[model samples]
Target chain A: MTKVTFIEHNGTVRNVEVDDGLSLMEAAVNNLVPGIDGDCGGACACATCHVHIDAAWLDKLPPMEAMENSMLEFAGGRNESSRLGCQIKLSPALDGIVVRTPLGQH
Target chain B: MSRCPSASTLEAAPIVSETVIIVGAGQAAGQAVASLRQEGFDGRIVLVGAEPVLPYQRPPLSKAFLAGTLPLERLFLKPPAFYEQARVDTLLGVAVTELDATRRQVRLDDGRELAFDHLLLATGGRARRLDCPGADHPRLHYLRTVADVDGIRAALRPGARLVLIGGGYVGLEIAAVAAKLGLAVTVLEAAPTVLARVTCPAVARFFESVHRQAGVTIRCATTVTGIEGDASLARVVTGDGERIDADLVIAGIGLLPNVKLAQAAGLVCDNGIVVDEECRTSAPGIFSAGDCTQHPNAIYDSRLRLESVHNAIEQGKTAAAAMCGKARPYRQVPWFWSDQYDLKLQTAGLNRGYDQVVMRGSTDSRSFAAFYLRDGRLLAVDAVNRPVEFMVAKALIANRTVIAPERLADELIVAKDLAG
Candidate 1:
């Protein structure tokens, strides 16, 4: 099983099992995590799913596409490792990736 | 041409943080932030916004927010502390003046050059302002933001003579609420009906009769050419030179995407930022969603910009997934809803390209559903206070299946039973 770690803004760590085809965003939503709203239900329209991906795995994920990059530009508390979680799909290769949460959203 | 200063400094910074930076806070912005956290991404996230308040919904600004039924706190997608607990660092009332796409850096109005690996634009849409004579009169108002709603609510002091220019959803919603509060309302529409282009003829007629019955003076096939008054509008002149009494005038022409920033950055822009099914823009490393981006929705069978909360939230999720390299081309049914005059109108799917329509229930009953069929396939369903029918009709649109007219008209069959 693919394993992913989520470090909330308050420093709470949660480990989750992920199917190869499921997205990181889908995994979090399915597990009932609170920080990510995913209001658009994985559409690129809502920026609530912004996440800071672990830098070590940055090269493992594909480069930010035009649409995803444009949206990350609007996320709250943006950072260098900032990425929308829905844009990251779990894979066997990215089995041990970790991400952090931002501080404010509105 | 003069450029916003922060944008220029953006090129110098290198994106090194684990958090994502989202500029322009709005409904789409808020949804993106929430989705990122829910998706198990634990990194420092920053949201820069030009507005001072937290991201709240705008649809209710014209309806419940204006009517005072929706409290300001309820308007919030989440309480302010919720974002704090979520660890979303929001810089409000601060604009991103410059963007260095090459460097993946953003320059804020305060001259902070921050870098971002991923950038999302949830800038949302804005109200198309009027430019007619006396359009700037203090008495004239345009509804789009929270401040605009607050001003209109304050102006709606009992017995105010409110003149609503452009009898579309916004104007009609205000009219309905104002009439109930004992304010004399006049709705001016250029089309013969209040909502001609947006809804079916029957739907438009239904709203017209509802407003008239409520004692709202709705003038169809009329245009306001000029507004006259020193500070506030005192009178409005029509295309035919007819003058009408007015205390406050609200112009509800429509909304356009906040695409100036994106356009300046050399991103492709059609009527909106054109995105494929996954909400990808033409440029590499950039994605546009929400009202600012237009996608060829398989559900609509046409390129369109959806301004509903549901659309924005769903699209935001798809964009996040695409960014995660788990791209599933967004293919979801489109749904929308509106409330006016105690009547709730819900729609699933696009009614365009429909050749035939069958009324499933009685409009006279004040609760019914209209099934729009194209080539014997269900295209859309407009339900008025009929949530049950709306659900099944949504399934019907997704399935593209046909329902017998007899079964549809029979309430005994019920929506759930027809699902079989």
Candidate 2:
């Protein structure tokens, strides 16, 4: 299991232990962490699960694809660190990764 | 004017904590269960589903799942451990035999009785089938559940002949996948144009062309008179006297809202279970949501029964909020989407009572948007391969902003700027 920390817009931080094969969004959702809607069920079709990855763990994650980037553009408050939580797969290398959910996802 | 009481007003009323029972284990029920917990409702959540499996996403069943690009396990909305961890008691593969609204209890098919203080009817719709003779042949299929798609996928082999009985989104999506998998797909539509009921003729023509280019035959204005032959092979007889041989036949006519259970309980049901702005049926303490509900929308000002994942989620969230004494009405604008081949069709708002359609981009490029307007107010938009415009159009429609037809057609003006 990988330990991931999720910070909500209101500064509510939740530390969750997620299986390696699960996505970061899945981890947050499974732990009942609020603010990450995951409306499309991780299909990359909806941008409701947008999150800003911590700079330290940004390089540890895989690069965002064109589809995911396009979907994130629809989300409010997008930035260079902006990523769809569903697109990021959890792994041992990113065990201590931290991410923050944006204020508005729709 | 708000139709339901405000959250603060509802909180001021008397509070009674009791178990919440949600019927039908589909997308709406799944959302209701999660939303109840999110809304801080610590009561027991008993989710009763007629199907044996847990709640799963249905959209991919026709697209990625049918094309073999998505795995079966991924179709699940959440991990199996979610219910156990959330303290949601799931009773699957058991149908609710009767709803004793007076007694606040529900009888299961297996002779089990469950009582609840609040009941949520999220019983979604079923796929409409062909009523003609030989429609029940073994080879004929309908895509609604996991077992249904599994059967269809097994029959969809290379060079197989597939006759889709409808030209709606479901049928067309399957056609796109079947054609890519090297199957000879033929779509039979009773109307003169595909997607005529949902979209304008110009947009329907574009999809018809896309399907034809992908080697799928679309026969519009052709009615299927009957079906013949045995379990091995079938033939579709059209009103035009054309007999088309089919290795497999899948019916995607439309959906019939699963309101039988609700109606039997004396709930007010029109096209579906009649729900108000707060997703409450005529019967108090019982709420409804998802495709099985016909509710009033503040945006359209018309009664509608939407069958989109967006509506299901929003309505489910609204129902949960109301049950928790938050009482937020279901006021979100409706939106829909369809994935056919490489094109992604996204729509916002209803195009009903439209007076004009303005094209924003080149149709030949297959990356354009059509904005529908009634009088001067923006009503709806259909965006294909243009996510930016679709996003902006959603905001514009929500605000009811009116843009000149010329400006909408012009490519120089940024879509986001139009909102300003």
Each prediction's TM-score against the native? 0.76, 0.95
Per-residue lDDT tens digits for candidate 1, residues B1-420, read 011113223234322235577776787787777766655445677888888989887877877788897577656665576687778899999988877777778788899998875678778888888777877788888998898887777778778899998887788888888898899999999998887766778878878888899999988999889888666546888999988877788999888888877787777788888788877777655667788888887765678877777767777777665555445577766777677877877777888888877787777787888888777778888888776677667667777787676777777885666778
Worst 10 residues of 2 chain B by lDDT: B1-10
List the DockQ of the predictions in order.
0.07, 0.54
Tell me how far the alpha carbon of residue B280 in candidate 2 is from the true structure, in angstroms, after superposition. 1.0
Every model: Cα RMSD to truth: 13.3, 2.6
Winning candidate number (TM-score): 2
Candidate 1 local Cα displacement, residue A59, angstroms? 54
- What lDDT tens digits, residue by residue, belong to model 2 across residues B37-99? 877777788999998989888998889988888776677777788899888899999899899
Query: What TM-score does model 2 achieve against the real structure?
Result: 0.95
Full-model lDDT, candidate 1? 0.75
- Each model's chain A TM-score: 0.92, 0.95
Stretches off by above 4 angstroms in model 2 are B1-17
